[model samples]
Target: MKINSMYPPGASGGIRAYASATVDGCLGIRGIKVVEGGRDGLFV
Candidate 1:
């Protein structure tokens, strides 16, 4: 299964919470990867 989670580059807690949830459902998985992307707009 492939899971793609997208967040607003700097949405602090969003990424953290998503990661925790993914790990919680892992059952003897061979491998997993967490990829993050930056937002496509101004930082301000």
Candidate 2:
């Protein structure tokens, strides 16, 4: 899988950022969320 883009949120709301990625160059995924996690700190 490869990341297409990662954009930070405009405001803080637990979510750290937004992301997009491709898998195996044959599939596409969009609007993947990245957020805060307990203990782990960051969630993706």
Candidate 3:
């Protein structure tokens, strides 16, 4: 499944919300976990 949003990363807008939703969906799949870090592709 493909998901797209208009919110920016960690910006508390649609993008961030979409990311969180995607994470939840990914987790729903057995043995699948979407591990994401950093901020907007930059290392933390």
Candidate 4:
């Protein structure tokens, strides 16, 4: 599986970022996770 991250060009209303993942170079999935509170974190 491979994963990549992408940041919004500017403000995204409430979304901060996005990410995508692919498995076996065939199927793929994308989404975001919201952390209520944290100092440092990773999206994917």
Candidate 5:
């Protein structure tokens, strides 16, 4: 997975940012929520 675009949220609270993403370079996702927490660190 790769982040195609990322920008900080206009408001603060649970979500930290909004983003678009791709899997193996294909445009397969959009409006994905990015948040903190998880053993690995970040949860998409």
Candidate 6:
């Protein structure tokens, strides 16, 4: 799996960034957001 990540302008706090992933040269997934969690840590 391949992943890309970024922090958009004005993004802050819990929801702070965005990402995308590609699998086996497929068109793959996009616009996956990143958020901060209390205990479970970050999730896709």
Off by over 4 Å in 6: none
Deviation of model 5 at 39, angstroms: 12
Clashing pairs in 1: none
Q: What is the lDDT of candidate 2?
A: 0.90
State which candidate, 5 or 6, has the greater lDDT.
5
The TM-scores of all predictions, comma-separated, are 0.22, 0.81, 0.18, 0.40, 0.58, 0.62
Choose 1 or 2, whichever is better by lDDT.
2
* Ten-residue stretch with the least lDDT total in model 2: 35-44
| Shift of residue 24 alpha carbon in model 5, Å | 2.0
lDDT of 5 by residue, 1-44 (tens): 98878999877666779998889986678888878665666687
lDDT of 2 at 36: 86
- For candidate 1, write residues 1-44 as lDDT tens digits: 43444334355532322321244566434323343345643221
Tens digit of lDDT per residue, candidate 6, span 1-44?
78854656364668767878888878788888877787998876
- In candidate 4, position 12 carries an lDDT of 52
lDDT of 2 by residue, 11-44 (tens): 9788889999999999999988898886889877
The 0-to-1 C-alpha lDDT of every candidate, in the order given, reads: 0.36, 0.90, 0.34, 0.59, 0.80, 0.74
Q: Which candidate do you rate higher for lDDT, 2 or 6?
A: 2
Runs of candidate 5 exceeding 4 Å displacement: 36-42
lDDT agreement of model 5 with the native: 0.80
Which candidate has the highest TM-score of all? 2
CA shift at 3, candidate 5, in angstroms?
A: 1.3
The worst-scoring run of ten residues by lDDT in candidate 3 lies at 12-21
Q: Is candidate 4 or candidate 5 better by lDDT?
A: 5
Per-residue CA lDDT of candidate 4, range 4-38, in tens?
Answer: 65556355544555667788889887775433234
Of the candidates shown, which would achieve the greatest lDDT relative to the real structure? 2
